[model samples]
Target chain A: MTEVLRVHEPGLFTTIQDTGRLHAIASGVPPGGAMDRFAHSAANLIVGNDRSAATLECTLTGPGLLIEAPCLVAVTGADFDLRVNGAPAPAWIAISLRAGDELAFAGRRSGARAYLAVAGGVLGDRWLGSMSTNVMAARGGMHGRPLATGDVIAAGQSAMAAVTGRGLARQLRPRYDEHTLHLVAGPHISRLGADARAALFSSAFVVSPDSNRMGYRLEGPGLETSGEELLSFGLVAGALQLPSSGQPILLMADHQTAGGYPVVATVVSASMAVAAQLAPGDEVRFAETSIETALQMRAVQREALESLTS
Target chain B: MPPQRSTVKVRIHPLGDTALLAELGTRLDTAVNTRSIALASALKKRRDVRQAVAGAASVTVQFDPDQVTHVALAAAIRRLASKRPPMEEPGRLHRIPVVYDGPDLQAVASALGLSQQKVVEIHSRPIYRAFLIGFVPGWAYLGPLPDELVLPRRPDPRRQVPAGSVAIAGHQTGIYPLNSPGGWHLIGRTSVRLFLPDSDPPSLFRAGDRVKFFPIAE
Candidate 1:
């Protein structure tokens, strides 16, 4: 058994997540997987765990750690300055910790969330085949709450010690940017005024501070529909909901099971991974794409992931 | 003016990549929407269909293109449509208790020009049906609320509407099972646990479950 690491400071927002709930959409459950799914998987690759292994999803910052035993760990997604036992630890490099070593991660720079993966995955209770703590639903992961100071986290096993390769760790970095995200028009595209729909694709939007894993409320031209009242309807990931005010809010991983607002567009799933990296105060634009192109991109990403495991 | 009946017709169009486009004629009332749901369920039952979802008046069927071409699926759906029978299984009824006190409760009541108690009474009067579930886990989109309660959503949605917050937007009423940003007009709250992840049936209300609000004094 690996020793427990005591958290001295559990930064702004930290939660345990694996790949989120899958195939539960029809059950009124959104796939609340890791916001940065690709990064979450890459971190697992560093430690020889399956991509769906539960790991720490730290927000803009992370916690101060008190390591009680030596363990293999790696950090991926977002460039957060990490230090081990007060010494500089290389970013994107797998490193071993001796007994009593302390680790700390600073605020995010290039990405909104950073992943810290360890060997054998972080031990946690699984709800719906994932340790992804959907704090909103109060289910899964370290007691359905974000880690706090004095929290104890233990590595799965000493077997995580067998896979040791710094090169592999460095290769799991995620590509992130503050540019535009591509979206295809949703079912209610006609609900939006022509000018509003055009502006939606052409204009840039800033991610509001109200944003979280559930969605990103964009600050830009609000879309006004000719008709307002419609029945509440089924929605999908990346659904751009335009309320009466016309401002669009892009739904994300933990988004609701259904909604009523007019949908301006649905961002392609492949681009949503990049969208998750957006932090508050980041500028973003929207571009329109064909369903064919979006599906092709999703297919390519899925094939790449399949190759990784195969 | 006569009520618009065109809003509930279910017309399907393929968007390629297993996704289809559905256009509902215009007004979204119960009888027409019920037909939409029946159609969605039938189309979704096919093994080749990946997703069959309904919007206001239309149902989009996303299917596996490699397994079943759009033409074939459309033909199959049209065939199914011809032989479609009326809903034999009426939905189940659930009476949920709600505390009429949320951050947006007073605002919604004022906007509707009714006392909070009256608002609750009107909201609880209708036997609502689950239109669909999609925005968040365990959020039941119940609708066709009394015309009196039809009110516009908040100009600005709250950053976080706590779980079980019973809310209304225009003609629909719903309970948020998880904390989420929503524009719906808040009328009350509940603690009946709409979603229990560990439970065999995670959601309290499924699509087609009948619902009515039971107001509890705050």
Candidate 2:
């Protein structure tokens, strides 16, 4: 391992993440990782690293870093104003940097999160077989917290020479502005009012400011449920639960292991990356879909990603 | 412990493309919780599944869509759910001591129209089962509180509850493993640590575990 960069300024909520800690979920630990999985992998692939390599997941804003070694880096996910050595740089493509090169994000031009990956996967403390940070649990990735100023990042030295000139195709780059997500009916669909589907589909919902990696609380028409109060039950990312207020909360990467609210629908995995891109005040619409269609969408997404990694 | 239902109607529904939810009735029944844990345990051991987390009455099974489709995984889950789980390995039993001197203990007793000592007696009388481990790492949901002691969560939640604070709400009680915002009524505090980040498992309680709390002078 070699020191790669030092944080000059750690902007809004930057953390090191990989695909996340999947096996630890059974132990009540959340799969805390890149909110946008596709972007995370794309960033890593562009830098000629393993797709599951840990990278910096900068939320809303990004950090300023001073490069200390010859390295290849790429940024993906939310669009941001990236600069290198005080010069403008493009995102989603590999860029070569040497000692003394400065990298920084001025602000988010669009989108809510971004990924910065360097070759030889950024090193972090391994927890549950992954380096993704679990802030609440206070483990993994910069001591289970966001990167702060003065922190030095170490990266495993890759034997392959640093590669550049790789970029994701325009069509393959996910569009976050669509704001439309597909969903499938949940098990507790029966508990909802008859117009629940219509209410969910027809009404325009806005992502509440109280959103985070845990879940997005949507503000819209109150979905009425007819039965007695429900008990706590296991939930996963993408569960669209209707609370007493009728508004729905879409679970995300860091969502609780269980909740008691009635679930009306679950957003498909294909649309999760899109959901992760949304920021507070973004208009989000839901399209009802079937399981078959959901899987097909997911397959298509996976195929697009494979083209990059392979 | 609540008695098991004669029949538990389990339905496997798609939580999304990547996860499946297996529902096992709705109430806070220990039997249903046990089954949920069992199903989760079995599914977690398989290579196909990414992981499985058991809730009070459900198990959310997560998997990779590229490797297996919802239909195939659902079928496997159905087959697994149908089989009565192998003789269960009993979960670890914990005997936690709590000093019943929380700020809300007196208020709770007055609200329930009982003496402070009587309220403490009722709260400590029953053996509670760990239905799930959630709401934060190591913060367990141990419950089916004695009916007399059951009360709604406080209307206003505190911004930060002290770690190790033993609290109660609707139908359950739990000790705060970490300092966090909470709405439950605090009734006591404990010295036992529920979470150890340095430890492999971290969490002290797992689903299907038994929790018995007793009064302590400290």
The collision pairs in model 2 are A222-A246, A223-A246
lDDT of 2 by residue, A1-310 (tens): 9899999999988999998876666566787888899899888888888888999999987899999998899999998889998899999899999999999998787889999998999999988778998888778988888999999999987755666878888788777778999999887888876697678888789989999999999998888887877777777888998877787899999887777888889998889989999999999999999888988887777777788766
**Top model number, DockQ:** 2
| Per-model fnat list | 0.49, 0.75
User: What i-RMS does every model get?
Assistant: 3.4, 1.5
Residue-level lDDT of model 1, residues A101-170, one tens digit each, is 8899965567888888887788766777677787756778888889989988877764434455543332
For model 2, the stretches where C-alpha displacement exceeds 4 angstroms are: B1-8
User: For model 2, how big is the iRMS in angstroms?
Assistant: 1.5
DockQ of 2: 0.66
By TM-score, the best candidate is 2
Model 2, global lDDT = 0.86
